[model samples]
Target: MTALTTPREASDRGGPVADIGPLPARRGRRQHRLAPLIFISAAVVLFILFFLWPGALGLLYSFTDYRGVGDLNFIGTENYRELVGDDDFYRALGRTFLYTALAVPAHYVVSLAVAVLLTSKTAKGKSIARVVFFLPWLLSPIVTGVVWRWLFGENFGFVNHVITQLGGSSVAWQTDGTLGLLVVVIAGTWASTAFNMLLFIAAIRNIPRSYLEAAEIDGASPAQRFFKIQLPLLAPTSFLVILLTTIGAMKEFAMIQALNGGGPGTENMLMVQYIYRTGFERADIGYASAVSMVLMLILVVVALIQMRFDRKSALS
Candidate 1:
C-alpha cells in the first residue's frame, strides 16, 4: 500500500505537466525571438553589400567628375544638366522603349504557348523537345553572337548565301538599320523565351488535377477551362514572369551585343549599351552614372505601377 502511494505521488508530481509545461513554451519563445533577428541581420548584410553601398557610391559619383582615375571634383547637377541636351540619351531612351514594347509580349506569348504544349501528354518526346527548345539559351552569349555575326556577315555568310541562291541580291545585313534591328529583336526573343517556357511549365504542372477534371466534366473545353480557370489561378505567376522579363528586357545588353553590337548606326542601341558607351568608350563616368540613375528611376517606377496593377487584379 505504501509502495503504491509512492508511485502515485511520483506520477502526479513528476509527469509531463511539470517537466514540459513551461519548458517548451520557453524554448519556443526563444526560437521566435532568434528567428527574426537572424533574418533581419542577414537581410541587412546583403542589402549593404548588393544594393545600398553601390547605390550610395553611384549617387555620390553622379555629382562629380570621376572619370575612372585621377582628380575628382564635385560639379553639382552638371551631369544631369548635360544629359538634357545629349542627343544620345534621347536616342537610347527611344530605342529602349521600342525594344521593351516589342520583346516583352513576344516572349510571354510564345513561351506560355510552348509551355502549355509541352505540358500536354498529346505532345511527343517532351524532354527531348524541351532540350531542343532550350538549346539556344544554353549557349553563351558570346558564342551566339559570333555565330549570328558570321551568318549576318557582309559576304560569304549563310544568310546572304541563301539570298543569292534564291536569285535575290546579297544584302549587307548588319549595315541595314532596319534589317539589323529586326534580326536583333527576333534573336533576342528566340534566345530568351525558353527560360520563360520553363517557368510557365513548372507553374502549370503544380495546378491541381481535380480542378481541371471537374472543369472538363462540366462540358468546358480546353480553351475555356484554360482561360477561365487555369489562367485566373495562374495570374500571379504570369504577372511575376512578365515583370521579370520586362525588367530584363529593359536591361538587355548581351543579346544586343550578340545580334547587332548595338547596330548599323546606333539605331538598335539600348540604354545600358548607351551607358556603357558613355562611361568606358567615351570616358565620362559622371555622365554615365547620371544616365544609370535615370534608368534606375524608370525601372523603379515601372515596378511600382506593376505592383499596383497586380494587387488590383488580384482583388478583382
Candidate 2:
C-alpha cells in the first residue's frame, strides 16, 4: 500500500527515506567519536600529571641547584659531576647490581620450575596451589618485609629459635651487612617469585601439548623435552621476566627500609634507597635528581637491549 516517491520529492518532504543511507551513520559515528575521548580523558590527564610532568620536571631539575627549597640556580651538570665522583653512590650502585644479579636468577629459576610443575598433566589441585603460592604477592611489600625481618631477627625469632632448638647457634641476621643483604635477597625472592611463576605458567600453558607429545613419542627424555621444546619456546617470556625482575631488584628500597634500614653502614643500600636518602634526608634535590636520571638511563638501556634480543630471537 506504499507509494514510491522520487528522490527530489522525498528530500522536499523531509521523510524517513530522505534521512536514510550514510547520513545517520555518519552522525552516529560523530556522536560516538567523543565517547572514546571521554572515556580516556581521565587516563590521559593522569598520565600527563603524574608521570610525564614529574619526570620532565625531575630531568630539568637535575642540572640545577634546586635543594627542594626557594632559590634555584642552574649549576650546569655540577650535580652530575659530584654524582660521578661520589664513592658512596658507586658503592650503592654496585650493591644494587649485585642484588639484581643474584635475585633475578634465583627468582627466575625457582619460578620456572614451579610453573613447570604446576602446569604438568599429573599436577593436582593446581587452583589451590596457585592461590597459596600467590598469597605472598597479595601482601604489601612493607608487611612482607616486616614479617621476614621479624622471622630473621637475632634472638627469639622463629628462624633463630628453630636453629637454636636444633643446637645451632643463634645467628645475628640483621646486624651483619652480608647476612642482612642475604636476608633481603631471600625475602625479595620469596615475595616476587609467585608473580613470576604465574607469568611462566601462562606461557607454558600456551605451548601446544602436541609438540611435547611428539617429542615423548620419539623417546625423548623429560629433560630433553624441556630443553628442546619448552625452553626454546619460552625465550620471549623469559626475556620479559628477566627484564622486569632486574628493574624491580634495582629499584628495591621499601623492603630494605622495613628489614635493615640499609644498616651496617649502607652495605645493603639500593639505588632507589640512596636516591631517597639524598633527596629527602640530605635535602640534595639536584644531586638526587641527577642520580635518578642515571638510574632511569640504566633501566632504559637495559630495556632497549632486551628488546633487541627479543626481536632477534623472534626473527630467528
Which structure among the candidates has the greatest lDDT? 2
TM-score of each: 0.84, 0.90
Candidate 1 regions off by >4 Å? 1-44
Question: How do the residues 105-223 of candidate 1 rate in per-residue lDDT, one tens digit apiece?
Answer: 88888889999999996988999989989999998767777777788787857989899999999897888877887776677777877898988998999999999999999999999
Candidate 2 lDDT tens digits, 184-261 = 989998899898998999999899999999999999999999999999999989999999998898889888889888
lDDT of 2 at 19: 46
Q: After aligning candidate 1 to the native by TM-score, how far in Å is the CA of 75 from where it should be?
A: 0.8
Best model number under TM-score: 2
Root mean square deviation (Cα) for candidate 2: 3.1
Candidate 1: global Cα-lDDT? 0.86
Q: Record all residue pairs in model 2 with backbone atoms less than 3 Å apart, i.e. clashing.
A: none
